[model samples]
Target: MIIMRKHHFLLSCIIAITAFTDGSQQHRNTEDVSDYFEQIRHDPSSLSAFLTAMPKGADLHHHFSGAIFGETYWNVLTESNGWMQPYTIEVDTAGALHKAPWIHFATLSRESRFDSLKQAFLRKASIKDYDPSAGPSDQHFFSTFSRFGAVARYDMKTGMQEFKQRALAENVSYIETMLGAPDTAIRLAAGPAWEKSITGASLSDSTTVFNTLDQVYAALLKAGIGNTAKKFCHHQDLLHQQAAIDDSVFMLRYQLHGNRNEQPLTVYRKLLIAFQAASMDSLIVGVNLVSPEDGVISMRDYSLHMLMFAHLHRHFPHIRYSLHAGELAAGMVRPELLRYHISQAVLIAGAQRIGHGVDIAHEAASIPLLEVMRERKVAVEINLSSNEFILHVKNDQHPILFYHSHKVPIVISTDDAGVLRTDLTEQYILLATRYPSIHYNDIKAIVRNSIVYSFLQPDLKERKLGQLDSAFIKFENQVMFH
Candidate 1:
């Protein structure tokens, strides 16, 4: 009987040990599950998926002209009725085919190079090299746009379609793009007609600007690009109204421009007039000075443009701006100009966002300036590929990580996606791989900031943010199960 009791006690000891081991194993597996979830939720596999799943609010800084890509240019230039020009296919020193003599070639027969130009354009068109070691210059970089502008100048249908596809891919729900108005083009095309229109009470009259925008907006809408992407968040029927206005499908925003290199007085007057018209029509949100960056007039009149934005801000406080400032580096602009480009944009011009704030560290009193930006919640539109390609600022050289650490608002964007042969997805991937320490949560915040800082209507923005949250939740749940 004593031996039997001993055996039973041994069996009990074995059972206890087995249970303890099972419990310990379960605890370890639970800890691992938690860690895995954190990584998956914080830094998902695909940056594109993260962006797509992210609730993107707005794309405040977008240029309609630059947003369109090369293939669309090739397709439209080939198909347009009378809009084709002779596209010279010349191989440069690098063995890449590039179109030359833009002015003269804009007049060629559309049918001339229809067959071979498509493939030729693709082969020669520039794409981002994805190399951190090398980059392009500001002048040489922006100059490439002029080379391709001839192809993109044809139609709105192809341009808008491609724009939609890209915006969707980038997880951008809304975009505020700047496009040339019909009147601006007409004035350029018919110099005499422009002089005649402006002779009577300047272009500031809301009536006149609205009329021009109306024609262009109608053309875009009639091209069958309405309520397709999503609902027309806001639309006002114009037939009954005094002067008509037809808004675009997406939460589209507009900005007008004047030549910065032109006379100071001329630039100011044009800006004021444009701002007034924008406020009156509620279509335009800002005015910009676009031209070559290194030109004599752009340099001389840089301060003058900032002064104009400051002066006009008081009158049209409703209008918003995200000016291109500090897109230069050490050698691109004079030393004196570098210190104040971004400063003036923030202080003098009252810019809501600064495009390509590449040289912030180079700017004088930059710490305080960054502080001001942080306090005010003004974001820097970071185009990583653009910075690497144009300014060649890379690795520890780029200040994006600095901005992140300092709690400054930042949004990763594709500055000239088509021109660079990249997308927003590519930018996110670049950031993820380059800065792996910044996990998925931090990246999501940047994605959130993109929409939070966008130029969309307030209500629409809120709605879109809600949708983004839902996507993030869905993505998280799927990863948890897996």
Candidate 2:
């Protein structure tokens, strides 16, 4: 008995020693990699190569339509017999642009004028070669969507496949992309009912507001909105199957979003449909509000939009959402408009995440709000390039470091990568170069936050996290030995 007890103790000690040794070695490896990163941090080319090989966990704030490159949109347009107006480079699927001024893609291709036309189209369709003197950067960035929207939705499968391929190449393991918008028919159908019900009902009166929303909800169901949600799910399933976008190495999920720059009734209907669809579809994980936050309608109906979200949350509490709040700067809107968005998004709308919380510093009770975000684990999606181009917020002026200092979870994302002519790697590069204070382990934690804060199912999230763990082990090994 004494000898057996002694042997058990000896075995326990050996196990402990082995664990400590392995853990210490891992720490050393990470430190060594960090040192190497510091060495090449000043060299752009080498830094790009290093970060490109690093495994990025997920892009939590990606937009599907904005992810497709200009070249891809052009190819889809030309292949589908679309015509482009030479002056504006705007495309029309119908023969609307078939008159003298517009050129057919077939003729351009036949005459070898395709390359020149494509270059011109690229200039207009993306921020490639954009001149700041020509217009406001934000205006240019937002206008690109209209130019490409005619063809952006043509080949959903191909566009998804393109994003997946690009993600895999950049060592991104998962993407929770925002896709789909409110159904126009449903919005129109619910419009009259919503306007009538909400006309006399004060937003502050919860009972009256709730009853009014219920009436609109009933109207939406009568108008076949539920069927619309189901069809949207079915279409997503077909796209996933056709594209084979998910595998052990890469996974994709989607969020249905609504443009907030619409009328109050239209916005509410869209959010309701989005919530209903997300509740019914596993692939559709969450909902978001998109479009320019500084637009007239978005600004005027901002608080009302939060009230709409709050109403839906009471019913579909299981469905999560991330909001594009505080995508604004001081001069972009009235100074007072910037003060309440991020706070209201969290406090009222119960947003699990916030996209482009750039104006956070302007938020009322900013420090307390940061505490709330940290305590509640409301992660912020940091889009370095997009903020720089749109809001001119970058470097020391950017709140990313402030969020980090407050321990608010931050996930770096590519906001309209195609339009910005950048990618996840470039975002990381900017992060590393601009904010050297965010060390290697801190960056790794941020990478993990992308998956942790994602709207993926609990089980799938766990699996992806485990996969990320393995990927990092392999990545760090290469960085160390190679």
Candidate 3:
């Protein structure tokens, strides 16, 4: 009996020793992985592989136009079967697109007609000589889109596919891109055809007159005997890579903007169609009102549009919304307007997320909403470069640090990456540098939050989220322990 007890004790000791040794080896491996990731974090070029390995779940606020590269837009324009443009641009002001206003378009161009026009057009549309110290930098940044819009409208399908390709290149596993839908495309087509008919209407009368405008616009949109619809579908199908469409977890959400330049009722009709599409189709996720923040029309309808959203939300409670609110600051919008924009977006429109919530601190009623956002898990999409360049909101003054303190889930995004001349990796690095309190794990947590905050159908999201976790665990084991 004594001999048997001695043998059993020895066996138990052996097992304990083995476990201790194994645990020590595992600890060493984990430390090694931590060191590797730290090294990669310090090196800008090494970020891609590390980021790809990280379980980056989704890009919640990627703009479709901005997500696409300028090279792609240029290539698309060049390859179009039927595209003609005789205009060009010249820089009126070195860093401000809106300046030198005393000079008219004709006066701005003086060289040989072609060279002058070419130079002018390039200055207007492309980020030719953007300066950091300029007043209202977004004036130049967002204005560039207008120079290229006519060319971009020539083909929509190619643009969508190209955007998807760019998102994938950034190692984004999932995306909910914001696009201007076909309904808006039709209105844009018909806009210039009737310039003389309504040129002299008063602002008050313009609202009532837009009732007639809606009928005409709808009729115009519904015109062409379905051929345009068929053509659009065919082009989209032709360009869409089947494997990419299948393997990619990319989902596009159309953001039909009510052109601030148009009448309120016109905006309402556009919003209604956009809302209806969201209510009816899985492809259409939400309706957003977009245009330049400082545009005369956008400011006029700002409150009226919030009221429109309130009316629409009552009918389609299930449809999701993520508003581009508080993107404006002192120079962008009047200080009086700032207080209500974000409040109305949350209280009136019931936004699920706020894109570029840079001016939240400037808003009077924003504190309660901030608390609500934290409790409700309503995320704020943070696009570092866009916010920095547009609103001059960066460093400690940026509201995201406050949002973090309030526990508001934040998903770092690329608002207009190609347009802003920045990438998601650069944005991430910038945020990390600017807000040093956030750790690597905090970044991962934000990635997870982006997926959770997405407007995707619940079942598929759960399944994909499960797959993401599995992938993350597998990669972590391989990289950290192997």
lDDT of 3 by residue, 1-482 (tens): 99999999999999999989977876675466556766666666666666655556677777666666555555554344222244334222222234332333344333255354454454455454665565347777877776566555554566677656655676566677765634434444445544334443333444444554555545644654234334434444444444244364555444544555567546655666666666655655666767665568667666656656666676678888888888786766667777777777777667888888888887886779888888877789998888777777789878888898889989988877667766676777776556667766677678778778888789867976776666565556688754
Task: Find the candidate with the highest TM-score and give its number.
Answer: 2
- lDDT tens digits, residue span 230-349, model 2: 777788788788888889889888899988887767777778778988998898999999999988878877777777888899889899999999999989988988899999999988
> Comparing 1 and 3 by TM-score, which wins?
3
TM-score of each: 0.69, 0.94, 0.73
- What range of 10 consecutive residues in model 1 has the weakest lDDT sum? 231-240
**1 against 2, candidate with superior TM-score:** 2
Cα lDDT, model 3, residue 457: 82
Q: In model 2, what are the clashing residue pairs, if there are any?
A: none
Regions more than 4 Å wrong, model 3: 1-41, 46-49, 81-129, 132-136, 182-244, 248-253
For model 3, give the 10-residue run with minimal summed lDDT: 88-97
Task: Quantify all predictions' global Cα lDDT against the true fold.
Answer: 0.61, 0.86, 0.64
Per-residue CA lDDT of model 1 for 1-482, tens digit only, reads 99999999999999999989877865564455445534554465644464454445456556666776666665554444223223545312212234444322234434465456545555334443333333444544564565455455444445655766666655566666665322221122333343244232221343543343344334433543333211111221121132221223234556666666665445544565556556555545566666665578777657656766766686678877777788777877778778888888898779898888888888889999999999998889888887887777777788888778778899877777676777666777778667756666677678778768876568766876777665555555554455
In model 1, what are the clashing residue pairs, if there are any?
Answer: 42-440, 55-468, 57-451, 58-451, 86-108, 136-389
Please give the ranking of all candidate structures by lDDT, highest first, separated by commas. 2, 3, 1
Residue 366 of candidate 1: its Cα lDDT? 91
TM-score of 3: 0.73
